[model samples]
Target chain A: MNKKIKTYYLLTAFTIFMFGFSYMLVPIYEVFCEITGLNGKTGSINSTLVIEKPVERFVRVQFTSNVINSAPFKFSPGKKEMVIQPGKIYTTFYTLTNQSNQPLLATANPSITPGKYAEYFKKIECFCFTHQQINANETKELAVQFIVDKKLPSEATSLVLAYTMFDITKQLGYKLEK
Target chain B: MNTDADHLHEDHKTGIMRWITTTNHKDIGTLYLFLSLTMFFVGGAMALIIRAELFQPGLQLVNPDFFNQMTTMHALIMIFGALMPALVGLANWQIPLMIGAPDMALPRLNNWSFWILPFALGMLGSTLFFEGGAPAAGWTLYPPLVLQGGDALPYAIFSIHLLGLSSILGAINIIATILNMRAPGMTLMKMPMFVWTWLITAFLLIAVMPVLAGAVTMLLTDRFFGTSFFTASGGGDPVMFQHIFWFFGHPEVYILILPAFGVISTIIPTFSRKKLFGYDSMVYATASIALLSFIVWAHHMFTVGMPLAGEIFFMMTTMLIAVPTGVKVFNWIATMWKGSMTFETPMLFSLAFIVLFTIGGFSGLMMAITPVDFQYHDTYFIVAHFHYVLVPGSVFAVIAAVYFWLPKWTGKMYDETLGKTHFWLTTIFVNITFFPQHFVGLAGMPRRIPDYAVQFTDFNAISTIGSFGFGIAQILFLYILYKTLKQDVTADNKVWEGAEGLEWTLPSPPPYHSFEEPPKVE
Candidate 1:
């Protein structure tokens, strides 16, 4: 009987430990995702590189934007399309307008597809790299600077880069609206 | 030690209180079985609604939201409420008797475990009337979508939490009873296959149930507390939820089926009148299957956008499960190879379980190939695959266990003719209901929708009719049970001619206590 009682406690403790471990999986996964960029995330580049005597390989880049969760914001690229050389840097701007009555905190996640081409699409600087905060009825200009790698497979002619904006005010513990 | 007096004393309570307060293993087993039966009908009705709505598509019977709610709730009720509890009921009733123990190691906890279920389920079932109706987000409760659910979400999560607690406690009791309460000479390897399978299952429940709790808890907090564990906007990845949930969810499939494996392993040999073929291998196979379950979870997520290497790895590991599973199937057939087999209702159901579950397994193998799953994922093919496994696989085994043991428990022999009628009706309609799903699914009809294209109409109509037939057959099952009890025809001590076990040594409907004194095994 005493032995049974002891086993009971041991099993209970194991259950509790697994419960806490479940929460721990979140952080562990986040670390793993960051390292692997497993969830369509691209790494940030701190130093800008200048391509001299560039390959000048022209590739058509298409720009698009979306709001996740039906967030009350109108977001779009400054230009719908551009043709640029792969080895040289280019900058494009996007317009974000807060249509709601309250200030909002948002995050923009970017994806480039033909997803395999994402490896060659380098972003030296992009507004999607950080959170964006806009006040009520505020409109903001966002910039993206990138150089598509010349080493990108020759068969690839064009790539679509899209940005998805997410409502982060509730998730990040900020109550900016009534 | 005054062990008999301590274990076998009569309960002083009467009526509802006897059920509410009784700690006896058999009484609790009865409670769990009744609860599972009730939930099975409740969930089954929801399934009928789904089938009816899909009968000819075009939203004939219910609105899409209500339809989604039925689909979602049916899975929740069946998995957590019906199938799991039924297995536990069997464990509670049979474990002590088979092991030669006086009772479960923790009897009081056993009582608490059975009682918590109704309250948890009541909270769940009442959600139909909630503002904006019940959760339509499907059973996976994948977020961003589930976060859009109405007032019922919290109640559902809380119910799952309660269910998890009940399972853990029951598992602890089973483990303790098996480890410490076995008869003088019964060793671990020498224990019945049913006991061995359940012992492995208990470890699985202990290990994975909390992981499910954690996943649902994160969902709760994400909805209420603004935690971004799965919110993509807050740098939390929604796919992470899939990884976490399936980490628990894959093992959960085994948690439901392994005990069914235990039941099937027990039944086949008795009917064949032979010692279980490859008993040592069956034990090893079950353990191997349990271990394999953990690594193959990502097979469920092959389309959730994992890398090529990850996909290949998950695919390989998933296919490897076929080895042990095939071992189990081969052993059952080998046991029945040339023995004096009697096709009693239990044996019939067990035989059907093997054939149908293997069919389900083959489909499972088809989907395990990463490329093939990309085509099959979320299609009616996937639906067909799981339902084949779950309904005929788990549910059939549960039915088999009931037909096998109902006489033992009630001390009354149910009419064998009515029993066979239920079995044939079930086996025929179950295949009718789910088999065409593979046809429609492979031909490209998606699942969880209220409407389908005109091309898929015939198969869906046939499938729905089959479901109704299956549902009606169960009413006959109930009627047979009622007649068995009401007619008062007593069963013999050794109910079957070929039966052999510590359980058979005791009288039919054994005593208030499982054993008045522990009996020696060998």
Candidate 2:
């Protein structure tokens, strides 16, 4: 009977340990995803690359903007498309107007098309990394500084950089007038 | 320990409190069985609703959103609510008796484990009435779409947590009982196939149930706590959820079916009137299948656009599972080769299980080839493949086990003519319902949709009618079970003539305190 009770406790402890281990899988999976870019999760770099000479090959980079249906905002890219040399820095702008009666908190999620090139598309600066607040009828121009790595896969001649904006005012406990 | 004193002291308790507070294994086994039966009907009703709605192609019965909810909830209820609990009920009733143990190693925990199920299932079932009408994200509960689910998501998550806890506790009890409570001289290899299969299953449960718990917990926090573990806006990847989920999900499919393998293995030998041929190999085959289950999870995700190398690797590993699975099927056939055989209800189910489960296996092989899966993925073909394995493979085995053990448990013989009639009705109807799904799927009928293109209407109508027939046959099953219980005719101690086990040595409806002296095995 004592042995049985002891084994029972051992199993209980193992179960608890496993419960904690499950939380750990999140970070472990994140690390794996980052390392492999397994799900097109783009990586951030701390230092800027010095490409002494930009690549001569031109890739067509297109900008696309969308707002979730519930989000009361008008958003669009300043330019629809551009042809640029790889390894050279490029700047693009997006315009956002708060269409609601009150202030709103929002965030943008960025995705790259031909997902294989997401790892090579380095963002030196982007508004997607932080939350932005806009008051009633307020408008803002957001800047994105980026460069396509010369190592971007040759198959991806045309890349679409898309950002989807979402309204988070409700989750943060702000009221939206009906 | 005096056996007669223990029996008198234990059996005197009456009323609901006896069930609520009792620590006896048999009472808990009865509790588990009854709970599973109630859930079986609940889940079955959900299936009928799905079949009814899918009967026509023009969205006549339900909106697409509600249709998605029914499909999602139906799977959750059937897999977690009905099939798993039934197997646990069988384990609770038969494991101690077969191994000559007085009771499970942790009897109090056994009581707790069985009791947790109703609350979990209750919480899960309550989701249908929630403001969003239940979780519309499929049972896999992939994120982003699942993240968009309304009020039911948290309840679903909590219910899954409770269910995971119940399974983990049940598994611990099964492992402890099998390892420490076996009669003297019954080596691991010498244990009954049911016990062997369950032991492996418990380990699989222990290893994977926590993983499922973790996945759901992440979803809970992501949905409620503003965490972005799966939210792309917060730099988290949604596909990560699939990897974590199928890691648990693939083993879970095996978890559902391996015990069925044990049941089929037991029934085949008894009806063949021979020792199970290749017992050692069967044991090894079961273990290998469990191990193989872990790596092949990605076969379900072949359409996720994984690299060719990854796809090829997963495809190869998934196909390799056929080897051990084939070994199990061949051994069952070889056991029946040149042996005197009887076609009783149990044997009939087992024979059907071999042929039909192999067909499901071959379909699985078809999908494992990465290129072909592009056509079959998320189609009714995939649905047909798994249902063939689960409905006939797992569900049929559960029914076969009930018929096989009803005599022993009830101390009265079930009506054999009715039993055979129910078996035939079920076998034919089950095939009719699922077999046409393959054709419709091949004809490009996508799953989880309420409406379909007109071209696929004929097969869907046939499948729905077959489902209704299948559903009606089960009502007959319930009536037969009730009728058997009401009869006063007692069963023979050895109910099946060739059935040999420590369980058979005891009386029909074995005593309250079985194997009080711990009988020795040769």
Among these predictions, the greatest TM-score belongs to: 2
RMSD of 1: 3.1
Write candidate 2's Cα lDDT for A98-139 as tens digits: 998888887898888766677888888899947788888999
B323-382 in candidate 2: lDDT tens per residue?
999999999999999889998998899899998998999999999999999999999999
List TM-scores for all candidates, in order: 0.92, 0.95
lDDT of 1 by residue, A131-158 (tens): 6778889999999999887677899899
What TM-score does prediction 1 earn?
0.92
Stretches of model 1 off by over 4 angstroms after superposition = A44-63, A69-72, A78-93, A99-105, A112-126, A129-133, A143-161, A167-174, B1-11
Name the regions of candidate 2 deviating beyond 4 angstroms. A46-48, A51-60, A81-88, A148-159, A173-178, B3-12
lDDT of 1 at A100: 92
Report how far off residue B433 is in candidate 2 (Å).
1.1
